[model samples]
Target: MTPPPGWYRDPKAPHLERWWDGTAWTEHRRTPEVTAPVPVAGASGRAKAVAVTTAAVVLVAAIVTGAVVLGQGDEEGAEIETAPTYYTQAPTTEPPSPTPTQSEPSADDPAVVTDELNGITLPLLDGWVRPKYVAEDDVVMTTDGTYDCPADGGVCRHGLVMSRTVTSNDERSPEALAKEDIKEAAESAYDRDTIGRRPYGGMESHEVVKSGPVAVAGRAGWFVRWRVTTAEGPGGYVQSTVFPSRVGTESPVCVRYVFDAGADGPPLADMDRITKGIRSVDDPDGGGGVGSSVGPGEG
Candidate 1:
């Protein structure tokens, strides 16, 4: 038979009563009720108030307990809405090592070469081979490569030269001397007739690339750069500088570099250092002031 919708003695626990809503047992439960407290004589009001307050507190506690029990009971029979969580670890990776690259030669670390005969010292391009001083001429250093002129058909050895002379009583400046040399070279090898239009040697053409004032041996000087034609290739020419001695004794000095027309020549910056480093010294031993000078022809 169906249970009535009211509180009934619990079959599982004899000391407690549970709610039966016709077909199902509810979460609500209660213990057997004890006899009510009787008011003492002349204190009925206080006693009744105390009894009412205790009942109210018990009722609230029962309601909270029922709610908790209800939640637990439902959890046992109901399907949970939460999904099962899963995690996957990612693979650790590292960046590739940087590729190795070649480092450029430092510009500040210069090469030094000296002319012992003229008592002159100058900086040279790094890796420059000291020349053999093959002739009485002013060759101090030379390149390893030799040029077979495509047009002229002979080897034009390329190198650096140092020329020095003590100035006499002439008051003319170094700039004037360099200008005079240029004029002389133009008139001697290059014809004054056709002049600026014709190509020379194997060079495609020539140009007065640069001209400026420079200082050498603590005295005023001039710097000149000339680009000339090679035989069906690049042109080569002489770069000369004129420096008047600072001792005031009128000593004119010159340092000239003759570069063969080619792509393999030392860069302009190195040439500039070479020229700027030229200074007069009192020693023919190729002194260590500029750096230890290698014995003649020693690189």
Candidate 2:
């Protein structure tokens, strides 16, 4: 059964009066009544004065007690206001975002070199040195492909060899010269092949394993390659490209990119990259004057 909301005697302390705030017993307590002191006729004036002072003290204490009881009644059924509790979040700690590291250029990347004399630029691989002796008309020598090794007892190391030659025009088509170069490779053994008018540097030039027409230094020219085998021995391979001067009717400019096929030379793709990157002074002004000509190996 539900109990009615009213004051009742405290069950825990029967002798003391406690306020029942409908739901529970409160801390309010009723104290016994305090009587005010009365003055007595003491025969002496001093005694009467002392009695009056005692009465005044008792009255003041009663007033203070009454105020405390009123304060308790006002606070009844009211929530006690305590200091608000706060919880601070721990400082967020996160691993620093990994800084993306960039990869360094490969050491095997070829060094770029330009011949200021003829304004020809290209990439040269490591260990390939410039030849000490160069012709007056020659712009640069890519050094000898064969490296002399005394430990091996002779020119045992063989690789790619490249050179540039500037000369007057021979007045011959690249395709015709390409065929002629193959024939003249060796009288004993000669074979001629042709790839007609392949695109090179926004232009078309005849091409073959033997030879082709190419552009270098802003002039059209023929590139010829020779592979011959005679009864004597392997005649080796030679690749030569000749370009006529764009500025005048002077001699043609020739550049040779050659290597012995049997000597474990650079791959054909690498060769194509080097060749396509060739640039002359008259070429466009970009990529350090290196040719941006798209070729067989280009993407």
Q: Pick the candidate with the highest lDDT.
A: 1
Query: Model 2, 64-114: lDDT tens per residue?
Result: 211011233344654332111112322234789999986432433245555
Model 1 misplaced stretches (Cα beyond 4 Å): 1-111, 133-136, 166-171, 183-205, 246-250, 282-299
Candidate 1 lDDT over 1-299, as tens digits, reads: 34346665554565676776766667788986665765656767877898877765654333211111223337467532221111132323598999999743232324665555455667666646656534324456666555553443444455445455534436567787776565434332222212232233423445798898986756678967777654355546667688765333556666666665456655556567777666565433423245445343343
Alpha-carbon runs more than 4 Å astray in model 2: 1-110, 126-129, 132-157, 166-208, 230-235, 246-251, 282-299
lDDT (0-100) at residue 248 of candidate 1? 35
TM-score of each: 0.47, 0.40
Candidate 2, residue 262: the lDDT equals: 47
**Candidate 2 TM-score over all chains jointly:** 0.40
Candidate 1 least-lDDT 10 residues: 80-89
Query: Over all chains combined, what TM-score does candidate 1 have?
Result: 0.47
Reference-based lDDT, residue 148, model 1: 55
